[model samples]
Target chain A: MIRRRFPWLSYLVVVTGAVLTVVPFLDMVMTSFKGAGEAGTLPYHFLPKAFDLSNYRAAIDQLDLPVLFRNSVVATAVITGSVLFTSSLAGYALAKLRFPGRNLIFRLVLSTMMFPPFLFFIPHFLILVHWPLAGGNDLFGRGGAGLTVSIAALAMPFLVNGFGIFLMRQFMVSIPDEVLEAARIDGAGEFAVWWRIVVPQTRPVLLTLGLLTFVQAWNEYIWALLISTANPDVMTLPVGIQFLQDYVDPTRTMPIVMAGLVLSILPVLILFLLLQKYYIRGVMLSGLK
Target chain B: MVNALTPTTTERAAPSTRSSSPAVDGRARSRRRQAVVAYLFLAPTLLFFAVFLILPLGFALLLSMSRWAGFDLGGIQPVGTDNFAGLFADGSTFLAPILTNTLLFALGTVVLALAGSVVVATCIDNLRFQGLWRTLYFLPIVTTVVAVGNVWKYMYEPGGLVNGVLNALGLGSMAFLQDPDTALPSVVVVQAWASVGSAVLILTAGLKSIPESYYEAAALDGAGPLTVFWKITLPLLRPSLLLVCITQFISGLQSFALITVMTKGGPGDATNVAALEMYRQAFSYGRWGPASAAAFVLFVVVLVVTLAQLWIFRRKEEDA
Candidate 1:
């Protein structure tokens, strides 16, 4: 009844907010089609004169969209795959397996989340550059460009997410011990029980974690930017697009950058739309994005 | 999420199979093997934490104390307290503009997003198609900061939509990011806009947890909508509100991605924040020692703010 009293007002507020939320994206899409000089000029039209698709073509050609796409895909896949596998494995151990120092390790995993990510940026970059032996670095981690030139740099710092492990562990705790014990009694090893029982049952959390990790990895900018700057060959979409933005003439190439961005975010947008339930659940579980 | 934010009760209370342990030979052998297997499962994660988490932290501390160029570990010259002192030294922008902007940026974001999300969340609690509305709000959250930052940057440009709208309304067009006075706040608005969706999600969940009878009772007592929100909803939603507040505040303090994409802390360092400064110091300027110092300072700020936030929240609950 209280809600019923202000129905129109509520709709007005929500719709207004929705328009505010969606307008920037609509502008981005429209601007992607705007012919050169038509955008970033006097009057700042909301719609393009014609929905020309040349910007997308230019974005692909100049920005090397395919290389960027492959790098993003590889990095996202590696990060997501690593996060899932390691999270599930560690989560199983923490949740079900009997062990010494289990409490310490679990607490360590929890404490990892306490450290803000920015603190690690400098050291992570340094260590990777000096990472013993890879990228022509010696055992003492001296000499070449290090792993920063490789695709692995895009995914390394993110491979083992503390939150992912914590999430998986929390969910795995819910799986009845009876199922696990029965499996063990049936002579199943701990690894087999984890693979056969815990993982299959925890599919929902996995999907949630996977989607979260995938989007995060795909959208990761600062690390990718750092690494990409070192070796442009490994540049991800965000970095490549930004590089183009940084180097190009904004008035002439704004549409191209917009087109690149639209293409860059498309995979993630579609994935999030399709699996949004799991993604939202992950955010709900994790609290902050 | 509220539960997850808290130390998990299940960690201590649930899923431990150790209660059935006995001295039987099979059990003893299995226990040994189980420990081995558990360690095996945990090895990769432990190794990663050791290398990435623990080692990096230790290395960061070292770098904060030593002066070194980008390359060569041996090039590090030990200079104790110099880096830390330099940040606060005379004529250092680190103290005045950078750290101050960081705090202001973070504070502004928390306030704006909190206000917006609360209003929208409360309204959405009464609406149909709540999921659809939430999904719309959450688009920015799923989008990369590049897209969010660049779009807003262009919009704030002289020839962009924001100024376009202003000119259409018979008002003057202004340079948003270029003006020193308006630059920080301009980026802050984008940060708040991008982050509001998740805060709404948390607050909506908070709103759902309130029993319907309370609102029903308020209605019977002739309380108006505003009074209902102020008296009943606000008090009931405090936990979730506080949850949103703390989480957003922590994130806001460290979030420089949007700033990087939009302003690059430019126009005479008007929009520079601590994290971005730290990033530029290390990567852009090759000042690793002072960069790490800035990072340590920033990390301590985050810690202090988080603790202070918790204390303030605790005091509020007590006062209530």
Candidate 2:
């Protein structure tokens, strides 16, 4: 009776909150369509005077959207692919393989999650800058820009995520030993067994991990900013968009920036919506963010 | 029960059987083969950790205790605790506003997010189309901080949606980011708004676990919604609440990317936090030594808060 009565209050609150949450995104879209002086003016207009496509053109021309999109896709693909491959490989070893120091290695993998990522920004950059023989550096990691001048710098530090490995291992632990043992006794190598049995069974988790990594790598800004500051050719979408806001006058270019944001976020938005089930499961499993 | 019993039975039978010596040798060989295969599988990940993780920690530690111009490794001057000392020296903002702002920013976000999530989660419990509402709330989480910060920054302008609403509601337009007083809180509001969805997700899970019978009994007893909530929901929801609180606090403390996107710790360090200060010190000013020291200081703060939460949660679990 309590649940049935006065549900109007619940509807009002939920709908209001949902609107508030969705309005900014709607504003971003509408503002993207807004013309010069239509946005960020003394009197706000929710709808644009005319639905303009010029901002989209201007955003592409000014921000080099194609290059940025290419960089973003490459980085995201590399990260997602590497994370999935490494996580599954290492997860299989930890879950099923018998070895000395197995427990110690698993503990180490778990402990890696304890270190906050901010701690690594300085050292990771330095290590990349000093990476020997990559970007004209000497064997002793000196006399050159090292790897920072290359696109790999954007994807290097994030290649192996501890949490991905941990998530994969936890899920993989449930696979019955008999499944692998049966394959093993039938003359299949460990690699064959893993590829044939374990990999197929773990597809759902792999998709979840891949989506999570893809979204994160796509949205990563600060590190991309740092790397692209060294070489602009590797600038991802977020970095490129931020670069516009940093240098270009916002009053004149706010709409273009908004347009760029709309375009930039579209890929992730579409991917997330399409695969939200897997991604949401990933979040529920992570519980940390 | 059978599944549970099989593992123990197999374990007990393994050592009791004395198989042939050749079989034992074959088992040993297979075990060695498995170990080799395992290491082969883990090679890439382990190598990455050795270079990226182990090496970086040692390097950061060395850099913190020493001074480097970020060019020549051989030129690093070991200065002991001087970098850490300089951060706390008189006239340093590291101790006063930056660290202070960091704490306040984190605490404010946690409080606002926790409150908003509790209300929304509770209300949402009685609603239809809950998934739709949650997905709507989750839009900002998926969007890049670049988009989130810029949209919010524009909205903070006098001609933006927020101020327009203020005017419509008979309130004066306020300088959200320009004024030092409101800058931090404005950013806090955005952060809370962005994070409230996840908190709600957690709290909703918590809410669903509280038995409906409690509410039924409360209704029969003529208790009000607020009272039933306080007496039943809040108490049962403490675990999830604390989980949300501690995690949000930790992330809030570490977060500066949105700040970088929005204000860049501007208005004369009014919104500056420790992590952003550390970033500026290293990247902008090229003060690698002090920056590394700042990183360590912030790391210790985060570690202490995390450990304290764990301790408190453990104690609470024991009590429960």
Candidate 3:
């Protein structure tokens, strides 16, 4: 009918949505480039009068951004690796293997998903304090807070994700049983089957989980702030940037904060660009059920 | 002939007996081996869960029942339900407003994001450069929330870009984050903007899953665009819509970074959500007992709402 004849209205809607989404980001970029004096001016200009890189340079110096970036990278990498390794293995077992208490274990893992992390803050903090690692006391095991003030603490809490296990299990269940049976018939060991057979088949899911884990760990703030308070060297990018907001002099530090924001954002943006297809697939798969 | 057959049959039978027995035994052994390997593979994940999730959750419950000063190592005295009671009594001053704000914010965000996503999804679904539009719409979802919050923090600054645009359009500048009246709503809008991308992605997938024949048939029936959308598109999209609602609710309730960065529960606690309030109590005010109680409340709220939504959706699906 006439409805299908002209779709320009649809095009208009797309353009409007795109513009609405893009404009704020463009503004952020422009504001970052603007001088501190020009930042507070009314009728905000889309383009800076004179572009400035001083903010980036100053922010790098002021925030000690290199240290923060390194800490974030190390923590995020460790956490992501741990989560991927642990969750995939658990997920494979849950989906493929017959074991006693399999359903019980699966249910327990799923139940963990419902428990809000905030509830555990006080005790988890105390647990970290009394952990026998770096902050442990003179009695060795009795003395220290373990990894509390170290980068390890940042990675430790999120090393196992119930959601990751769930997602991986769902993906693994979709694999054809014949393929697995063939591997078994070929005299492949279980580990070998998981490594050579299941892992290869499950790369997409792994990558999806990896990206999600990386993003979550990278953006995490509160836990990082709480656990890493004793060691400035272990502070992450989000916490570092947040501290910069209040620590930097309001007048002169605006640009530096903006630069920090830009630098902190670049990795995720680059990641999305590189893996947009898989990201979208992951989103659809996880979100739509 | 009988003598020759006996020799051949004996030779064949001996080999078959020899081969089949080992094969069966090997199969059984390998089955046990497979189970062992599976458990081995699962050990690391199970260990992690036991230590971090299970132990911490159990300890957290215990902590919620005790009194904890900021630095009390050996002084976690059992206080029974005092913390929970204290939280509920005077907690309303902080908790009530925060809860109300959170619910209001979540409702606003879910409704706006859903509408915007549907419109955008429908538009992109019909577009020629579909991937380009999808990427454009999805850009915000990938950008770190901290970065988004920071940028929007600037955007919401008094006489900042948002106000500048308004003033340029002959409207006066509004204190988007400073004024009590506008603060939470402003945060809600920002959240809605950040969230629409993911919602759009899901809705787009939902739209794609609708068979082309339905639309074709509807076109043959002389149905208009609105009529087709109402009758055909929406009915099929119930599942995705339900998902979007539940996810948005959870995320909104858990929202902290944006509020912490943007307002810090300011303009006289105008935008203090339960999650942020928990952070404030535990970290800022050093009221561990009260904070734990608040956190438990938040956990309960999230759990209850999520289950209720799931149940409602399940019932709807059953009826359909």
RMSD of each: 5.5, 3.5, 5.3
Q: After superposition, how far is residue A199 of candidate 2 from its true place, in Å?
A: 1.4
Give lDDT tens digits, candidate 3, residues B125-242: 7767788888888877777666777788787776477878887888888888888999999988888998998898888888889888898899889898888889999999988888
DockQ of each: 0.58, 0.57, 0.49
Segments of candidate 3 deviating more than 4 angstroms: A1-6, A138-145, A176-178, A181-187, B1-32
Instruction: Judge candidate 2 at residue A253 and give its lDDT.
Output: 91
C-alpha lDDT of candidate 1 relative to the true structure? 0.90
**TM-scores of all predicted structures:** 0.95, 0.96, 0.91
When summed lDDT is taken over every stretch of 10 residues in candidate 2 chain B, the lowest stretch is: B1-10
- Give a tens-digit lDDT track for model 2, residues A81-175: 99999999999999988899999999989878878988999999999989998899999899999999999999999999999999889989999
Model 1 / residue B149 / CA error / Å: 0.9
Error of 2 at B264 (Å): 0.6
**Candidate numbers sorted by lDDT from highest down:** 1, 2, 3
- Candidate topping lDDT: 1
Whole-structure CA lDDT of model 2: 0.89
Q: Report the C-alpha lDDT of model 2 over B127-162, residue by residue, as the tens digit.
A: 888887877777888889999999999999998999
On a 0 to 1 TM-score scale, where does candidate 3 land against the true structure?
A: 0.91
Q: What is the lDDT of residue A56 in candidate 2?
A: 100
